[model samples]
Target: MERKVCAAAVQFNIELGEVEANLQKALAGIRRVREKDARLVVLPEMWSSGYAYKRLAALAEETPRVLEILKGLTAEKNMVTVGSLPEKVDGRIYNTAFVVDNGRIAGRYRKLHLFSTMGEDRFLAAGDAALVVSTSVGRLGVAICYDLRFPELFRKLALEGAEILCVPAEWPKPRQEHWRTLLRARAIENQLFVAAANCCGIQGKLDFFGMSLLISPRGEILAEGGETETELSALFNFEEMTSYRSQIRCYQDRRPEIYGTLP
Candidate 1:
């Protein structure tokens, strides 16, 4: 019963004050996802620092060390892994998405949209590049935390031939409905696969809703995890995306001229 395109999400309760314990717990989930024959595995945002971006610079992870751990894990498990991490680059701390596959750091995506309303701008440096990593499974476009709120980034990725979108987020409570609504809307509109990995439990003063989802191109909820530390696993069909795009044909029927008509 091995599937070529199996996926899994780790919805873990990240212990806010215990980074070591959280890392250990999350490593276990990554291994579990591999054992289930998942070609792609996702972990929640800031699974290491627990969304404590205010202290990110002081506790930020080095690119090499994080890359080493993930490289080893992915090499041993032979699965693609993605999630958020606090990264220090060029003397600036960024909220980043680390992508590991086979035996190397495949790619990294930094959060472009700083959640200024939540004071993220005070802590983390925003990224400018839109990252899409190529893997054996497919081309994966990654966005971290608050980057999920931007439709333009996703559109650019779709145009760049990305088939699967990975959104690793620490989305909070009281806005749980928005999370689900936005995820489905993104999937349906883009005609691509969506895999959301969300953190559960409290970080500092914020509580995250861990209802991570794996959505089909047609916006069908292929698999979903509840608001707990659990795993959501499913097998996805790659052809469904192409089929939906052809049938919907929204991209073809675009009014690009009106968007930039030279008056």
Candidate 2:
């Protein structure tokens, strides 16, 4: 990994069941960030189609094609990117985030925790494993919307040599504080970088508050977006993370033997 790398997140309005429109928007956002020399980019969850439950199966069918497009773009720009799309596999639908690094599919993280409050578990099959993969940029840990609430998962990723965390979400209003606090807490506790993308605007009955963020190991907000369609970019310095970790000695002082290991 380079000592420093540029990362970005894209936020936009996801129209329900409008695969083509949403795809074009995502592409535009990716290009915009790439132009600014961002070697890694993250997009919002279910970006190709909002929570159009009635057309979810059909929408999921487009994920492969969309991924191909992303692969080509990443290769052309020499970038690594991640975003969530509805995936249909073996007749089961899952909210899956695909990590594309330089034209290859680096890894996939199916959302493990479905938001039962919104009936997500009823429609989508949950993922059983977490993802921490090596990419063109660096080692990355991936998580979806609801997965952010689970600190254990993030801790596992950090312990497993993940240097940066990428989150793709479609979080709605009335809980913006939770999003901000949890993201910072995850970075601070794990002593790594975090880049999260969230959609903005209204889709169906839900309104999304776009506050995509890029945070440092010290819980500093390097870059952030507002409640609108936009892109936020920041440079992540691995040396800074190493310095902070050495100074804090959090990992060195861990008592996993007494507290039990994380799965």
Predicted model with the maximum lDDT: 2
Q: Candidate 1's residue-wise lDDT over 149-246, tens digit each?
A: 88888888988888889999889898988899898988888888999999887777888879999999899999998888998888888776777788
Kindly provide the TM-score of model 2 when superposed on the true structure, using C-alpha atoms. 0.98
Task: Give the TM-scores of the predictions, in the order they appear.
Answer: 0.94, 0.98
Model 1 scores what on Cα lDDT?
0.83
The lDDT for every candidate, in the order shown, is 0.83, 0.94
User: How big is the positional error of residue 218 in model 1, measured in Å on the Cα after superposition?
Assistant: 0.2
> What does candidate 2's lDDT look like per residue over 39-117, in tens digits?
9999999899988987899999999999999999999999999999999999999999999999999999999999999
